[model samples]
Target: MKGVYDIGGIGLTWDLAVQGGRVPPVEFSVDPRVRHSFWALVVGGGSMYMGYVFDQSAIQRICALPTVRQAKLTYALTTVVTSISFVTLSFLGLVAYSYYTVRGCDPFKAGYLKNRNQLVPYFVMEIFHGFPGMSGLFLATIFSAALSSVSSVINGLAANTIEDLLRPAFDRYNTTEKGKIFIAKISVFFFGGLCVSLSFVARTLPGTVVQAAIGFVGACAGPVFGIFLLGASTPWGNIAGAASGLVVSLVLNAWITLGGIMYGRRPVPLPPAPGNFCHVQEVANITGLYLPDPFNNSTGYIDFSTSSPIPVAGIDSGGNPLYNISYMNYALTGWLIAFLVGLAVSLATKHWHEPTRDERLLLPFVRRFWRLNQADELQQAVKLRHSGEHSVEGPQTQKRLISFGNQTSDMI
Candidate 1:
């Protein structure tokens, strides 16, 4: 069992969690100038993108339910489960922190902490070390959960490849059943390999797997969410405006994300070590000592008590605000940028003046806002025919009809 972790004498509390248990309530930040609002934006945006909008699998699963009521019930259940899981994870992290602090074995000092992500797995190993067959079972469970995600990714990629790349490049590839199947297999294999290769790269990332993945997705989430928000909520969301907003948002997000990663980067200052974790040396005891790969940096014990935290970035070469903003804000930045730009573009664009009348294209939840599917004549087209203007298949009825719809537009 992990002992209670404390800095100096105070014990670690769930309220304070892993923030090093400072007396004055230390605020963890990469930069002092970063306000609570900025943190909130990123946290909200990242969470929204990862858990909802960007998670097509989750959306699909919810939609696949037999009834709307059932789907809503499932969503509620999922939310409750997710909240419990988060609490459980937080506890695990605290337990690990306590164990390390009490043992005087700073993970950073013990070696093999390329990124702090390894902490969770390392903690799991220590806790379940002596349990027979339990480790395998736990691993199996983890893999099984991960596999569901993997399947969704592969399916989405394969569909995208066929629709966007393969079918477009070679006509009739998707038209025939045999050709479609072949393309799907090829797409699955290609994307599967790509994802596998990326996993190796993920090992070297500076943050946790979830963080890195979320950051990447967050870069685009803003634009996506912006588009959906506009489409569902606003009558002025034309395709041209939406597309323009997305493009601009993409450029803006890319510039910030890449700049932060490559040039304007600054390592986050870790909290001062608890007790003699840094100054004094300690070793972990286990059947087989946990050894990191040779490429990992060897443990360097730093005297945090004496050394000051690394300074945050001041200004960029272009004299803009330091792009060292946390990746957490990626989605928020993108969404706001896209929404503003899209709104501006929509006001200027011609399409916004005359929006699409196709109610079928609108989301079911938002469909209530759209009064009619088409113009009054087109709207009454179906009703006119149904009242016996002409037979269902007659030339007169077919000629008057521009297209078929349940909502509106029986006439051209």
Candidate 2:
């Protein structure tokens, strides 16, 4: 509720300012008899939130697994199922929207793509009329997803705080489950509250929800993904390589995005209605603007709509088309850059040995093969022991078994 209010306030403020103090009002022009139908559509839209909730639940279930293999399998399967479901639902939503639009309903018709003010109407419409019975179900699913994510975050914080931070300070307190739970809950609550508050600030930022979310994820995850790849794929990948990759990715992304913004190249499009209306003829009529003759210095707003049919190409301040780069490609570029840089550095510092033992232990499927070898060795030792033969190799074999046992225990 607080988040909703904050977002609404911020959006409304921006909308008014952008329109030069004129609040561009959205007036619904529907038959009074179809008011209930409108509400139904709004309610149906609210159900989409359930998909998010289901996704979170699936993630939680996967994370609860003790082994990495199980977790990976669970995650993969769950993701596929959830993704399919989302796609199907989204398709249905598009169909429904098309139906409504054909019938003169435009629930999602908002002025600006970036501003929250435009989003508010759509949200309200969804809540009121989107899905009838499905809205609550979707909302519940969304709540579950939110709670699940919050739980995982709390769990991660608890693990890090206890194992890395608090345990080092108070060894005796580390063993207490209740104490750890309390700390985790407190941390989760505090962080969650902080996040909600910060979201209000984020709402004021000039970008669409999808773009903002994806950009944020890409910015944060790019270096982390690079580091993980380096650690997993190359023994030569050192702290220096990881650090370099992180720094380079961050700097490059920041420069590209911020530079674009500073130069008036907004990543997201502005409002499309009266706000964006411009006279093409007026723009072309300015004599000095793009005149072939330097002597014709008369300056006036050329009404482009009435001028010559030639289109005026308007390039953003960054000297590029606003929609030139697809966001997926942009994010991929960042990841690829990070990966390549990290790999190059790793190749340059080729000194570390492969973590074969750690790999075998960490990978359960590989560990199964390792267990077979151990079993063979154990059988060989047993055969020698039962033969009543005191060969020099028998003691060595027994000693090897003991060593193997220790290694296996340590791995476990």
Candidate 3:
């Protein structure tokens, strides 16, 4: 009842429109220049898609499945479940907005909350205050989520470090099983402590925890995903190309993220806090104690005029075009730059490089094309041999011959 009215009364809204030339951090305006415009959010949603496709942790789990069909099923189910969670969370955002709208107060603009990210907890507390254990349950839920994320990250870091960095040294030294176990434990502690220290450092950074986290992850993910894409899709990508792409893309993403944080302009003030509707006497009747004005004179009109020229939409507050790109585009930008640079480098070094002949390494579509070409070339070679004529040997011919010999040996 009251919940139904709360949702139905307000419905959906983009809040107040930006007046005068000021650009708000979030808006549903038609302008493509706004950082959080509808178009940007639509595109930024791809970041999650990119995460799903390129995330090593998820890939490792999928690979561990007993069969290819099982792996595919697991991937599909995981994506669907994760997407449903995201959609539910998005709906909750609307519910929070509706609750505040009905309450005739905005916690953030009223100075009760410093950041919008705090709104969830505040909303939970406000609604669950009368219920003795509900607020505590919400707190427990938060802790559980935090613990799950932290534990997974720490474990992944520990596993990666041991497998990629320490395994060779252990093998070289013929490390005992107990010694290996002890070192692995030590690595876990070391990584856990390191993650804790980094969290403190993150607190010192600009932007909310959500921004900093996604930016950091997007920057890292972009390059690594690019490398994986290159290796899987392109036969010409050699170690040099992969290395260059990884370094260049990582540096590019880091610069964009850091520059935006350090130099970005702040969003203009939101529309003035909703008019104070709570009366002092009414508060006394409800809680048996008088409460002062909760809004603290927050009704002042926003002034959009400023000395600096109005920034172009989509650009950060600093008016710089490059750094202000939507964070969602970070992974995509890295992917493109990496692919282009890698392709160029691979072509430049083509004389010394041998394209991978393993069909298993190529994408399914690419492998199909490879097989077609292989069959065509094999027919041509046989015809030339029967005619007792020599054809010019090229890199493709060499690769085809090697591939054919391997396949023949396997059949035998």
Candidate 4:
């Protein structure tokens, strides 16, 4: 009776979400801009953080493995785990929506939600509030996860700065190991401080928090993924080609993402309606010109029916249609641009004449191919040298060698 009352009081339909009849079809029309944002999220979310996890930390982790086989195994395991995590989170979102819809507390329609970003937290509270400390525990878990991510970012920044920039200069200065370590420590401190400062600035940055996150990710991800792909896959690629590709990709993607943000399109074609929650009243007794009306700051609901469109960003006053592509597609655009430009530059120039790269530095599958090619070349070289030496050998020695070969052939 207690359990039934609890379930009834909380409006729990725990198993209903899985049934087709109990749930709305999870489908909607998305804006082209939202497509880019979605793609940005997909690519950005693929292996954790694109900047650190893909570029710096993941490589370090891979290299730490005992063998190429182990590295591949690690990647496979990571993929499985991350896929599960993504699916689980997505399902949670669906569960939240379903729960709200069933209870007639659909936040989107009720105009009760102040920010869409708050939906998950609000849902967690609603579901777990009856259970003492569960909500707090859940929040703490989320906070801990965030802290881990920030730590990773700091570590990655330090490692990259040291390896790519600082160490090179320190090497030129004939710095000792201790000096290098000192520099690394300094780099970590500097970057950590910078990150702290930026966190504060990020609070004031214009636009929705989610939009800013995806935009920031889209800005960094495309060019990095492109250049990393080029470097890892192509032997004929040079710094010049990669730099050119990366620059073009970054510039193009940034323009598109920024333009997309400025021209704010709704993801769904049918914007959500605030179902009759608000009623307007005449404010005929307004005193001062500056204080005509007061709006409740806590509300997430806004009526845009009579509001003017946001002022356009970029070259044209109305925003250039050319740059209206979604931010999510930025990664794809940047990657393609970089790869094509990089490949063209590499092919059109002297990169083709460059010496063979270390096969070990590439994927393990390609390593055997390179080794076979090297072995074949070495065998050919040996054959050519033997043929030259054969011409200079005495007739008696040639006869003896022929006799030995005949004997060897007979034994076989």
RMSD of each: 8.4, 16.5, 5.8, 10.9
Per-residue lDDT tens digits for candidate 1, residues 1-412, read: 3223222222433433334542224345545234223454446444454436445556667667899799878777877887788667756666666555444456675464656777777666655767776667767888899888898878877876776677665674436768788979988899889989999988877657876776677786667787766666666677777888889988998898777666655555555334443323323243345533222325443223443443543433463453665676777777777778887788788642666456666677766656544445465776777787665557744654644444343322
Off by over 4 Å in 4: 1-53, 106-112, 176-179, 197-212, 269-322, 351-353, 362-412
Please report, in order, the local distance difference test score of every candidate based on alpha carbons.
0.62, 0.48, 0.66, 0.59
Ranked by TM-score, top first: 3, 1, 4, 2
**Top candidate, metric TM-score:** 3
| Superposition error at 111 for model 3 (Å) | 3.8
For model 3, how does the per-residue alpha-carbon lDDT over 1-412 read when each residue is reduced to its tens digit? 2333433443332231223222245566644335567665665546536655666566667777889999878778877997798776665655665555444555665567776667778877776666788878878998898888787766666677778888999999998889877888898799889888997887677656776776678777777777778888887788888889888988888888887677754444334334334343346658877543332336433222322344443344446766667665676677777877887888788779877767799888887777666567667766765675546667776666667767645535
Q: Supply the global lDDT for candidate 1.
A: 0.62
The CA lDDT at 179 in model 2 is 71
1 against 4, candidate with superior lDDT: 1
Worst 10 residues of 4 by lDDT: 274-283
Q: Which segments of candidate 2 are over 4 A away from where they belong?
A: 1-63, 66-69, 105-137, 161-183, 254-264, 267-325, 348-412
lDDT per residue, candidate 2, 205-265, as tens digits? 6655545554454545555555655555543466767777878977776565554434434
Model 3 worst lDDT window (10 residues): 13-22
**Model 4, TM vs. native:** 0.65
Reference-based lDDT, residue 352, model 2:
57
Q: By the TM-score metric, which is better: model 2 or model 3? A: 3
